[model samples]
Target chain A: MRGSKAVVGVYSYLDDLLKGIADIRSADLDYKVYSPAYRHEIEEATLPGKSSVRRFTLTGGIIGCTFGWTLAILCSLDWPLRVSAKDIVSPPGFFVIGYECTILFGALATLGSLLLYCGLPNFLRKVGYDPRFSRDKFGLVVGCDGHNLEDVKGRLMKSGADEVNVTEGI
Target chain B: MSKQSEKKEVSYAMVNDLVLRMLEPPGAGWWVLLLTCITLLSWGAVSFAYQLWAGYGMAGNAHPIGWGTYITNFVFWVGIAHSGTLISAVLYLFRAKFRMPIYRLAEAMTVFAVMTAGLFPLIHVGRPWMALWLMPYPNERALWPNFRSPLLWDVFAVSTYFTVSAVFFFVGLVPDIAAARDRAKTFFRKMLYGVASLGWTGNNTQWKHFIAAYLLFAGLATPLVVSVHSVVSWDFAMSIVPGWHATIFPPYFVAGAIFSGVAMVMTLIIPLRKVFKLEPLIREEHFDAMSKLILLTSSIVAYAYITEFYVAWYSNNMFERFQFWFRPFGEFAVAFWGMAFCNCIAPLALWYGPLRRNIAFLFVLSIIINIGMWLERFNIIFTSLAREYIPAAWGSYNFSWVEIGITFGAFGWFGMWMTLFIKFFPAVAITEIKEILPPPVRNKESLQGHH
Candidate 1:
């Protein structure tokens, strides 16, 4: 819940959504912060950790393509093929298409992964989201209920959320 | 708020205002106009008129060689177009700082060069009216072009290249267009720039998409420089002519294309930088870098030359060997030496830093190099064919006034187009220059260290 609902929070103490609720006494009122396991996986993949598939997009793609393609064509030599009285692996014939396909696949994979990493489609994004988020608010979110909302408002004030507001309907 | 953001736009006609000072020649030399450009344009024009009336055969071309000066020029101009994409896309991908001014000029050169090139295929047509038949379709006329032909592949390659280069050129021009749109007093310029700008607001998201499209187009078009010329080379390689049938032709041609294209760029830019007072913008550093490239490609070009001769010698196929070696010593020797001197020898002046930085020396050298490169093409095509496999079939080409006229007029046409373009449009990309300049001296206090 700390990273969810279009909010990014960096907490000084353990007043963050998960920790605050876990430590809630009877006087603190009731609440829960969703922490699904897959959230951790996505959070780990994105933003935080060094371990990632993203780094392989360009370099790994090039290596896999060139050597992979060279092996494929070289192995095809044993499969006896003849077109117009020409031998299979005469060395000169293999260079042209071999070089062309290697570049083609490497370029294609790099292009695809670059798109995924950037999260870019539809070409435009919403800006100037909320005024309060710029001033003193470290994080602002929508949808905190009234009972827990009041108690949550107090916690937010204590934690310096700046200007907390009730967010019910769209 | 939207209305207020629009008001802060600044406009200035930077440095020289050549059009306003009409009497003076805007610092550009008279010799450039008289020689390379003007001569070429007018000769091509007169020849074109003769061509329209009498037909293409008047250009000294006969049954065995139906294509002549026009086809050669097409290859030359298309080769010239490569450097713009090379500088803009490849260097941009590599983040080379020297590309800034030259890149835009290269694109302009590309568009003009392609325009000049596309004319030849039409003019060379046996039936000019049937030119549209090359467009891909299975038509009711119950005819289709041979799909297997390299000529048709050229149709795809060139058209794709033109579209992509044109888009890349315009996408990069948006900021400059916005500036022009703001400053333009006339309705036509305002409207033209307005439409060209496409409401570019310089917001971060707009920049993201704009750059994405630009880089994408550049990447797509980059290999085409190699592909287009290689495919063109295949037209010769795919042939059964002894000297022409070598497997080495594609890479050889590609290397030659790059070599010549850089030579052409040097020829154009040396004069332009002088005339426009762009010494600061198109700096000595830029010259040094290109001179190195010119030298490098020249050596590659020279290397290709040696290999062609050596292979012809080593192959032990007597007809092939004689056809290759006899080129420099025989009838085409002048063209062969001219090619060698221009591409290989002339650029060697760049070995010294002083010569590399000297605009006048570089300018003269570039001209010589272009001549050599042009001769290189003439040598390759004519020499190989003039002495084909059988001696009985051997014949030589002598250019008639008609052929000479068309060649002259092609240059004239290119000059007229380039001359007009430079006259009206802001020749330099101003806004881009502003962006690249070391972050502006924010305030007086910030400038303290410089003093």
Candidate 2:
């Protein structure tokens, strides 16, 4: 983002990280938290409400269920090649295809939603990134105006940020 | 030995280093193994090429045994795939902590096994190139594949299983791949990890969705694991073949799949734990837990075997009765009895806790169970087809070099992928292992005075 300034807080301990998150929240600033692994405590502290990935799964499953049956039934009717003298539209037989499609599509959609929400393949968006975030360190990035940049950095340092930096144009 | 003590000792950085170490440049042993796999794969490929050149008659598949060695190989490999999903998805949902260290490799095994299994159908079709006709694509003829046919169900089920599994496997690898990307030295490896990781930074937004999506994938996959084998079972059960037409084939096949799959996991992981020196992470307790699963599934399989016989007798059907009798006393009696000893009797040793925990014993038993499982499928496919409803129409399968070569190649194929995977990817999950470890915490006294 052009002209945007942010304060980055790097921490060594989970306790300090949670405290850092508390400080950012109390200030009512827009912030993003980073960690090496998923923690229920961090999730409970930083994010509100549940992830919307479930909606994508439900939508994909419904679409897949519809598509599977339509493809099976309509194709069977179009061809009209009866095997074993079974019914023209065999729901029992098609149920297997439908079930498999539901899972296949649901899984694909879940992956899609994850990518979209996470801004994945984001090769160029690395203004506040730290390699240690993937290893042992936790980070807290709070986006604020240039005027509030020093104030935010000071607060983050007091909030137990082992290292704090101000980055412009992030 | 308690998990609590182990959790305290392992650090996040150590988990990263230990896992990434496996991704280091291969040693001589690894190259030799890779060469062996490649050589075997080439031999299988040569056999297949020769078969394609000479015609379908090059293989032993004949009048009565149309679904011969190729089908057996297909079912065998698909069975090998079951334990991966069972461990990664099902155990994950149940919060089985032992799965943490081994599930990554298990999931990789599942994807590669499915890839190997997917090839058999193409190879079985003989023409191989015409396999695309199996899909429900638009054509000038306006004819779709018969959805009512269990064969068509196999196509859909297997393809769906493969797609979902590969997706699940890759999704789980993202964070670990990111870790590898950060530590990667070589430019090629760095680029590979960078692209594969999708630039994951472990932000809370990403973790929140990643966790949710992973949970949903596991839920979707658990039922998929059961349905896939069941659909594979329907390929046989839907037929009027005496040995295969039983109602119990779904659960029987599924339990057998898990039995064989878990055995395969043990087969792979025992060697892996030693080679990678991951004993601290993949402990004896994990094997013990896995053995218990094998024991449970083995009992189910044994019951299925007896039930097949009892049902055959109770049905008063001459063909079914004859099929059951011939399985134990006929030309392929060795396969039936071998399967019985390996699958039913061998796993009984696991009921003894000491044997389960003994890594050496588990490794040997795993190989035995795998052999027995292959024999079980062979017994079901070959014996059942070798003598069907009519004695005059019945004929034995011709053991041809083509099928043998192809079967050997299939193992090479699976082995080659596995050998390469361990060297390239973090065989052990870096992130999940760290997740289970106690997080670094500042002292409460120090924190109490802060904010």
Best by lDDT: 2
- What candidate 1 gets wrong by more than 4 Å, as runs, is A1-170, B1-43, B441-451
Q: Pick the candidate with the highest TM-score.
A: 2
Which number leads on DockQ? 2
What's the lDDT for residue B341 in model 1? Answer: 82
lDDT of 1: 0.59
Supply candidate 1's per-residue lDDT for B309: 84
- Measured against the true structure, the TM-scores of the candidates, in listed sequence, are 0.69, 0.97
- What would the per-residue lDDT of candidate 1 be over residues B84-196, giving only the tens digit for each residue? 77877887778787787677777777777777778778777756678899864546865444333467656656765676677667667665655555456677776776676
The parts of candidate 2 lying over 4 Å away from their true place are A1-3, B1-4, B444-451
DockQ of each: 0.03, 0.69
Question: Residues A3-77, candidate 1, lDDT per residue (tens digit)?
Answer: 112222222221233233323323343222211001221122122343222243345446644753454355444
> RMSD in Å for candidate 1, one decimal?
11.8
